[model samples]
Target: MSFGIFQVPPPANEPVKSYAPGSPEKQALKAAIADMRSRTVDIPMYIGGEKIYTDKKHRLAPPHDHRHTLGYFSVGDKGHVEQAINAALGAKEMWAAMPWEHRAAIFLKAADLIAGPYRAKLNAATMLGQSKNVFQAEIDSACEIIDFLRFNVHFMQEIYRQQVASAPGIWNRLEHRPLEGFIFAVTPFNFTAIAGNLPTAPAMMGNTIVWKPAFTQIYSANVLMEVFREAGVPDGVINLIYVDGPEAGEVVFKHPDFAGLHFTGSTGVFRHLWQTIGNNLPIYKSYPRIVGETGGKDFVVAHKSADAKAVATALVRGAFEYQGQKCSAASRAYIPSNLWEEVKNYMIADLESMRMGGTEDFRNFINAVIDEKAFDKIAGYIEQAKKDAGVELVWGGNCDKSVGYFIQPTILKVEDNQYRTMVEEIFGPVLTVYVYQPELFEEVLELTDQTSPYALTGSIFAQDRYAIELASRKLQNAAGNFYINDKPTGAVVGQQPFGGARASGTNDKAGAIYNLLRWVSTRTIKETFVPPTDYRYPFMAEE
Candidate 1:
């Protein structure tokens, strides 16, 4: 129904609002949080464009205030997974055949809605439900998700314009067709933006989706669904379900029409799902596209020439923000001994100055982990580090879960480079540092690269150009999103196309055209103005 040759205007990154003191956004967000906390809402599974409730209900509570029940989301089983898949398939034809402009418009409208009317509520939801500070919620749930939606629409337009050159007298056309079946979007609890992007990215490319967000994130996830529906995404185009992982996998992986997976989670879980999909390959109609962004043991390495204060700031902000749950968070560091004292002083001072509490209090820079399981897991790591003779807990080793799941921003100074906390993905506010002799910077680079199987995100802090260049080249394969003189986290949508390889999932570069390309199966069509008298006779005759 697009009558004109449409051009989606190029998009700008959504401006991040600073919920500054006495600012309107801050006031609105606070009011929204208060309003949400005042009542308990019942959330239902959205399957086939309908709200489906079930007997099994899981309580939704803020990690920082676990006793106060915010809501309960109806849980589904294998049956709901099947229904979601059916609904996705049922809507596939119309959605795939929809005019490209209209498809683009829906998501663009969604972006605008988030930036405008839904901004405060969504941010409030993220802060309460995911235990993110106001700043974290602003950057993630509001700005990042809005950026993803708008930027993805622009990227989709760019993908459609790419075509192969044609020979003289032949008209060659390439159509980026949607995958033959539905996409399974398994998202994590860490980022609300990721939960939104995983399903909507594939759906923007005309593929229907069965999206299953983490149970801990469902409270904010429901707000995103409302935005999607209000933005004019047709019923059944994207189905939201709440079910056990194995239950969903059992149904989705075995389905003949399951065509792709967009995932963000743990490496072990991704591996298991991949194996299951491979085992059920014979049952699928087409080879499924498995795209994922998984775990990271991300690093930060410092040279002797690096500014000690700058390095310390990067560490404190990069590793501690959102409790270091981000895939790109700096979990390990290789600090040269020349500047260790200065860096340690700065970090210790910063840690002492910080306060921790519920998200409603803006003064709390640190908040609770997502749940009790996460609290226990992180505490286990801290406990092990305390026991390990090779590592010393230098600062902030407090763990108090009596009220909420809170673990102090813990740091381990390690003698062993290959220490467990240094190599493993803790997925919490735990950063491990190993001080290397200044002269062995190159050897330390190799050590940093080899110590972890992950190549997700890593930063090099060096003032000397030679040292910076050397580290950059030597550790080129160490990180997919490499940072020089800065922290490794905060990869923006349009600027930094984020993802990593090796055990860190596929380096698909989620916000770029490359990620969108995965959802499309291209078809080449060549038309000739005149019929040939003989079937490709020139090569045969010459031979």
Candidate 2:
């Protein structure tokens, strides 16, 4: 490979195919899904390039059709977790010592693999494993994963180019060194792009990783591992494991060499992990780095002058896509009373028009939620809203888990901004609406800011520039990913760096240099060109 020292091509959002009727991409996806459904794969724990199988085999099934077996994965215990950790440590020296250019090359190849050869299979796996429809699967598993891989290379090059200033007699330079120990990356089932990014980001910067993906996301994660191996990521550099969270934590966190954590999961789990690390802080060789992106109760707000149809579309797409599992999905909305009637009409029509069913059919706009637990949790909230006099059901509020876990896209109309549904992070196809007096726009903005502890993402729709400007200024720290005249979900890689402050996460801003910086530590080097034999200062010489 003739790789040259160069700047990366500017990143642009990956074009999304409509996957409309009779489209080639659509056909390809259907074929892929059918192909995956026809066979049951045997997945093994990958430690140091070794495929370790276990007697504790767990069957894999689609969330949309839980009765059918798609595959089986070997479940690991504490011993396997320890083996993964040891493997990561074993590969650390050579992987970290390799030239930066070589590291960049490997990931770059992986991106190409995802974009070209592995595209349909990975997308199909996401649909079957996570219950996402075709379009949702395309954006996440195919496009977003490619974006992360390519953009990370650019970010890595950018990080390397940063040099320190030099004084008159000496040249000063700074080295961005990878952290000394292995990273424990715990990813969620929501996004396959995140599953690939969390561990690969650190490895791209010369760090080793013990990656434990959510059991639900493992089908696609296994595909990602294949891409990585084909791209020449060395043995033991990024060991993939399938172990229980607490069991793995018992071994990894207590180990003396655990250097960092890359996590994107529930806030409760992140907090517990943080506390565990704190309690075991003295056992490690150094303070372990904790970079986590937890839960979010994101929102959307509309001004009185906003277009009703546009606002309605944003709500439908933002709150219902992937069944509102996105961390940046709009869960709550504050609408002006003047526009509520028209907006509500459009929203209801859209919900009524949407089709919900299995992922094998591309025409269905809505698919089942991840599993039975998610279905029950969401159904409980909908049932509460139906029973409560204070809340009115605007549209769908039904759930059935007989064949698959299906929760209808539900809308709850609330008079108060402080309603429990408005403040809580319900990762489901649920949207709560609070219509405020147009005159109380300022108050509503304040209420929206105070409604949730999370500040991940939010949107504002307004034809009035002054109102838009006001909300932007008034709700400054309210959201890390803020949108204007757009839905809050679907943050692009390079354009809208994703993360949040407060309870949402560390706000390191993934998809940019900020996130990559977290994986590295800095060292300053000063080279004196002409060493003075005497260490005396000018004043001392004069004396």
TM-score of every candidate relative to the true structure: 0.98, 0.98
State the lDDT of candidate 1 residue by residue for 170-250, as single tens digits. Answer: 999999999999999999999999999999999999999999999999999999999999999999998999999998998
lDDT of 2 by residue, 465-508 (tens): 99999999988899999999999999889989999988988999
Cα error of candidate 2 at position 406, Å: 0.5
Query: Candidate 2 has what TM-score?
Result: 0.98
Q: What is residue 111's positional error in candidate 2, in angstroms?
A: 0.6
Model 2 per-residue lDDT at 7: 70
Worst 10 residues of 1 by lDDT: 534-543
lDDT of model 2, residue 361: 86
- State how far residue 387 of model 1 sits from its true place (Å): 2.4
